[model samples]
Target: MASVSALAQVDATPRVSAAVTMEQARMVDIRSLVPDISQSIAYAGSNNFVGAPIRGYQAPRCWLKHEAAEALARVDAALRERHMRLRVFDCYRPVRAVAHFVRWANDRADQRSKATHYPDLDKSKLLGDYIAPVSGHSRGATVDLTVLRCDAHDVDCEPLDMGTGFDFFGIRAHTDSPEVNAAQRANRHLLRDAMEAQGFRNYAMEWWHYTLRLEPTPDTLYDIPVTAPTDSGRQAEIERLMQPYDGDVPGVSLLVLKDGKVVLSRSYGRSDLERGIEASPATGYRLASVTKQFTAAAILLLAQDGKLAIDDPVKRWLPSLPKVADGITLRNLLDHTSGMLDYEDLMAAPYEGQIRDAGVLALLEKEDRLYFPPGSSFRYSNSGYALLALVAERASGKSFPEYLRTRIFQPLGMRDTLAYVAGGPEVPHRAWGYSKACDGWTRTDQNAYSAVLGDGGIYSNIADMARWAAALDDDRLLGKASRALAFERQAQVSSTPEATWYGFGWRLADGLQWHSGESVGFRNTIVRWPKQRLTVVVLSNRNDPTPYDLAISIGRWFMADAQAEPH
Candidate 1:
């Protein structure tokens, strides 16, 4: 219930100094004190909610006050006795980083990190409970950490599931939230018990956050950068890795978020080839199947409001549907298990023009049978989502686009996103799709079947997509239970590389929840490693190959060291 005005009332004050000698004399690197302790300094990399290295984190290292370091080392030693080790995510945050958080919170337009951290609450509410101009971490006595299991040799450590990822800005991450499973709650209790034994007090809102009961310098905030002297090479390496996406031809807009923050946002190519408009972060491209998730979300929202139940028969909302859909429920439609026939397949060859969402439902009414019995098997069907959109309209008494505009897009602050309709308002900063031609790039923006609203038809840019990604973190739009249901694996779909399952609108594979979009001249993919808080969104204007491979490669790079305990 936090409002933007409340955030504005908080004072904006700078609170740090650049004296290196004072910091060096008072602080010791936690790793130096406890070399055996595991460390994954999230703020030092792009894998945090901020998405980039925080202002003061120059390196992926943990530093703390001498006393805190000694006490943490004891915690590590004690954990080792039980075949576990203390894995620190953060320690001794710089005051500059705390200030960065404050600035981010104040910028209402910058909701890029909203989905990953503060999904259920407005940015304004975070000022007092979550973020502030000053932080206990700056005192060099506070730490954010988790427990990890180690092999007999104390190597190959893996993090235990504590219900939510570190820095998860939601109630699910609370130490006492009952939303988590029993085992997850137990893991959290174990961490709390261990940390408290060493004079560390856990912050109630954040399971991984802890502060010393008796800090050495509670009043002093340090301004020292967290980077090591040798980190220049690493910075150069990151730049080199992203150099390929810089150009002026029909280009790609890539936005990578790790832990809900934009770690990489690059635009390469042209937004308009005829006008020679260079593509940038504002470039909007049509998202084909990527739009399905939003459609699913709308249905979920209606269900959340008691307007409808997911288990209700499709006929409850759309009485015009054929009798074959009698056994099909809305949940079946959301998860692609409705066994609905593909509308595209039903369309006659040499299609006349673009088809809209209502037209899709009309076409379905003419069909006498389904591809399979409802919930009997798994088959990806665009028809299922299209119908769900219609159901949302019938239940809410609003058009699909209007429902999303007010419910999902506007609420999440996705200012530049929309469900594209044939005669709808023009999309701002639109990136026309293109295909490679013998002469050059050929504009092939929309297909004969492109106007469909539910299955695809959503147009969005990187900035808006980042907000959409952040909304998945908590229950501001959907309750925690509803959000969980969206990602819950409903049926087995494939078994390549690893088992793949179909959730509400997501394809789950090997700890990744992802979906790819493909249109006539546009190809895009959004991959989310939820547990790692890493997301890769690749949006392209050209009809190139699917961006799935590139997205996966990037996801792996960001999650290179992220390992969870075996299920």
Candidate 2:
């Protein structure tokens, strides 16, 4: 079945004497430590010199030896302090992938990428110097990346002008090339300085290449597929910690995930006290303020589709708003720095009925002034998100709920998750909220703002939320660049008891990304430790005890071994 060219290609590939197992290599994904670092893996796709997807790259993930990954995380952390980040192009090359590169280098017939990659050099000259038979990446202590600078608000980010593009096989790609101008050379040195401070030595020929000073496995190559790691133990301890929810009254649903696998999923108590239905992982509970994250995501999706820009002024879309809202931008709304007056504060005493998102917009349209000027300070405003829902509807020309269903939930295979619009579509496996009374728990679910679809009105269960958490890990629904904007610290919440920062819709505290929701009778929270690829979600129907602190305690059990400090 093989042709002469194919047989020759196979013969040119070198044999691998030995390769280490994953456990022996002790490798970790850089994303597990630096969650917000940007990645654009060139070889994993058809964007590189070979002009084809390389073999042995199952996923576009960056894995390095434990020590080297830690060092790279340090470099990323130091750069973030100055509103900068690392955008990696390649890491931890597999032996087979290297073989693919070598085979392509020897084939003189395939000159498709010549103009872009190796314009000045002959293909025959690439084997010894650039395309080596054995690469340091196979040993798992090497990485290729460039620096990116964010705007003053840390919202928009773009890569710096390096002298030459990555993988360019020419003298201009050299780290100390004299052909580069002053600004480009300065940018190159800036990256080198940051990486060298963390014990990385740059290759003199390539500006984007660097390796750890001390390699963990200098001789052996690692061939384990790049995938998320899953631990076998730690299930019983988690169940014991969640024992309180295993009861008869209105209760909670909990899900714990490690490396994208379900570690513990259990629900206790009754979802419907009247019907005598037991709670399970499928019981849908109102997300309350947690819905803000979905609303923010919807806006970002619209931006990605070229419907709107995150930096556009609110008045550009909702022109009927009063002059006080003129300076507010969509970024301010997502960051909760818009300073829009809380619509709840503007509601009449003992409001007659539940105010929908449009009503919230109407109330803001009449307000004369804001609590503060836009982007001047931080104040969580439900009004901001409600207005964003209207913007999403107008931009996409579809109802907010419909956009989420077709674009996000359906694509992610989250069948039961939905935005709760009364009398539109009934919730499946629904759980009614309850509050404690002197005698027993009382039904106290919907309130004046329950109908609002943006600030706090989405329903999901443990299973669906787990899918959402996994989607955030990669660019399945959101691109890598958009994720960086949403995860970056756009606002400083407080510096008191402990430092806390606010990204788009998530809270950053003590190296944990989390958010809590509270309504009339629902209290829920989700905590994520990106460094360990761990997540803990607590969705409760009774409001007596808040689950924010509880979720953090559960997250700590897994992140106890993580060494990277919080950004």
Cα RMSD for candidates in order = 20.3, 21.8
Task: Give per-residue CA lDDT, model 2, range 1-567, as digits (tens).
Answer: 000011111223434435455566788878668744566665655657887768876656688888999999999999989988777777887777778888998899999989988899988978866887677787778888888776554423456898777888878888889989989999999999999999998887888888888877666666666543443434434544554553335778888888888877767666766543556678899999888888988999999989999999999999988998889999999999999989998899899989999999888888879889999999988888999999999999999999989988889888988999988888877889999887557899999989999988899999999999888899999898778877789998999998898887788876678888999889999888887889999999997688887787777766664444466
Each model's lDDT comes to: 0.78, 0.80
TM-score of each: 0.57, 0.58
Error of 1 at 422 (Å): 2.7
Clashing pairs in 2: none
lDDT of 1 by residue, 141-166 (tens): 88888887755644334578888777
Give the lDDT of residue 330 in candidate 1.
92
As for model 1, its CA RMSD to the true structure in angstroms is 20.3
